[model samples]
Target: MKNRLLRFYLYFILYLSPALAFAQADVPAGARAAALGNASVTLPDLWSLHNNVAGIANLQQAHFGAYVENRFSMRELTTVALLAAIPTAKYGSYGLSFSRFGDELYSQQHAGLGVAHKLGQFSLGAKLDIWQIAAEGYGSQKAMALSVGGQAEIIPDLYFGAYAYNLNQAKLAAFEDERLPTIMKAGLSYRPYHKLLLVAETEKNIDYNATFKAGIEYQLLQNKFILRTGFQSLTNRATFGAGFIARHLLVDYAFGSTTLLGTSHHLSVSYLFSRRQAS
Candidate 1:
């Protein structure tokens, strides 16, 4: 059974390798960068739903967030996420989160459920994913995937993390014969002061493209307000953006401009609920 599962995974990877290559051919240029740049790093509140999953595991309280973005004035994207962390009697700490991503035009939906367990200085996490794509006049397909991640404390105030997404190599549909892209990401975060943090991440896809992102955050008004800024690079395009946080609410906005796409804008908002012990 294990060998059979392994063979299936290998075949899935082989089949999806070309899809990533095809996706790289057109090079959307600044689509992802414009939307995700300069967002939060740790519990970034609003953009965390799409930026990184490990960030959600660091939350001290239960949190829920919803966001919407307009892409190039052509499509609308929306997301909702819920996250919680609770102390356990023998397991140290446990974290859970669920997120959904959807677009209007093509009716693409991506949903994920994640769990993490903290052990001393190390943390492990895994995610189950469901993806679907459908259109008004076309057939719709769905797939199942998995993602695994880990985070470790490298120093007193610094941490490192790595994650592999879409590890299952699941097919989008039985008839479509296309596979979802697989991606790997690694990042580091540091806190220089009590209320300031710096983060950087590098990601690579099977499609042969690499991305580098960096951001910083500062707290103000006794932790009631926060400000953030960052930059990222994809191919030859550059993106920058900022965010604001007030108490349990957060708002983020980013802009990307390239010789190809001209200029694009993205905005997201989220709210964190009060901390509660898990039942």
Candidate 2:
């Protein structure tokens, strides 16, 4: 088992190297749309598992969510995520999350298990991701990756975060090398009041260009409905989304336009399980 794991890691590193080496190549324009434009990453639900693992650590309850993104001129992307957190006397709190990303033609699934420990005024966390990819005409492959992230309270209502993904790569198939994309991201979030959140994030990928995202979330109707909007520079697009929460369930939808293509839409649903009664 040890040897097999080692070999898998090796292959993963090999496959990913090419993409990094040729990082300058113009990546498929459509793929970029599928990536940064994903609204699920910013939503305050199970979908946050893949958007920012650190967000899941802050969740007050266990939640599960599924999302589907329809990208113009490309295959559909589907994702499902689960998040859970528990507080402990000795460890502060710990969180677990899992997510999958795939399309009809080719699919990639990522299962992540994570833990967060609060240190002083900051929270630190790490995630281990099990990755599997399947191609319609080719055999399936599996690999492993690791990520570390942290969130710090800069002030009473301001927070800062940083995360690194795919620090290590594992081999998944013979003669077919696939290396995970290494990414570094930093963001600042501010809660001016109880009902509003403003966020701005910048991300850098070893294999692609950098992008900036800014979003705002507002609550209405005594916190029963939420509205969100954001703009991304790399894709030169604006996104508008809304969410409805009733009891322990939340449903969200986002709409945006792509410069190179047409419009795109995303839908997500989440169920939250709280030990204590929800407010």
Candidate 3:
């Protein structure tokens, strides 16, 4: 029976998967970031609420965004996220983010509130995150994590960024030292021309091998249309994406492929409440 098979699959994952290796569980969101192979620490966008919190400081207008990603064409591996950013006159930017991964059989959810302050060419940010894990048969576990990030424009057209996720090493369970993934990332972004941008970054998780990523983006039609491509060393995945930007609304889509995981698709949409003019 289909229902019988589904139940068996759930039991297999819940009991056997963790023992093999506990997942990092820090799912990345946003088609733009995915299109760029996740080399996004320095890129500034609405979804920066999930990438580098400090990157939101670059926004001058209020923004709201929604994102969805389907990995390996599996509904159970899909991720959905909602994000918002509000910029102030004297203060910096405030951000809120919510994301969920997996289906009812198993899932992880995150809710976070963050603020980023821009100080001249440098910006700093911190977020308080509540993480929860739930399973169909088992109950749920919740913990708090702290994330911090900073971005700096080193020179004209060059920028640097770094972020620390789950710096406090929040615990998931007392047995087997089960805990949330703690990750650190640092990267650089360079723009030689207004139309072309390049990014490279390295990420390290205490429990896994370091991952290196790089991406290239080009804009056409005066930034109304954009094209992007990227590669990740961790999974040997190649990603391609494109974006269409109107006056207030932006839409982006990404496609990625790997020999092991088949393929993945990501799509995101965002709206800017108002455009900020130069003072």
**CA lDDT, every prediction?**
0.55, 0.60, 0.87
Summarize candidate 2's per-residue lDDT along 139-234 as a digit string, tens digits. 677777787777778889888878777777455555645455677777777889999988778777766788887778789999998888877787
Number of the candidate with higher lDDT, 1 or 3:
3
Candidate 3 runs further than 4 Å off: 1-24, 276-279
Q: What is the alpha-carbon lDDT for the whole of candidate 2?
A: 0.60
Give me the candidate number with maximum lDDT.
Answer: 3
Off by over 4 Å in 2: 1-45, 73-76, 80-100, 169-177, 276-279
Q: What local lDDT score does residue 274 receive in model 1, on the 0 to 100 scale? A: 68
Best by TM-score: 3
By lDDT, the better pick of 2 and 3 is 3
Considering summed lDDT, which 10 consecutive residues are worst modelled in model 3? 15-24
Model 1 pairs in collision? none
Model 1, 1-279: lDDT tens digits are: 995675455435533465522232111111222433432223322223334444445555555444444433433233344444443444433444444433332345555666666667776666676766554445677777787777778889888877776787777655555676777778887889989877778877776678787766677777655555566677444465666667777666666556664555655555666665665
- Candidate 1, after superposition: displacement of residue 128 in Å? 0.6
| TM-score against truth, every candidate | 0.72, 0.75, 0.93
Residue 127, candidate 3: Cα error in Å is 0.8
Order of quality (lDDT): 3, 2, 1
lDDT of 3 by residue, 220-256 (tens): 9989999999999988999999999999999999999
Model 3: how large is the Cα RMSD against the reference?
2.2
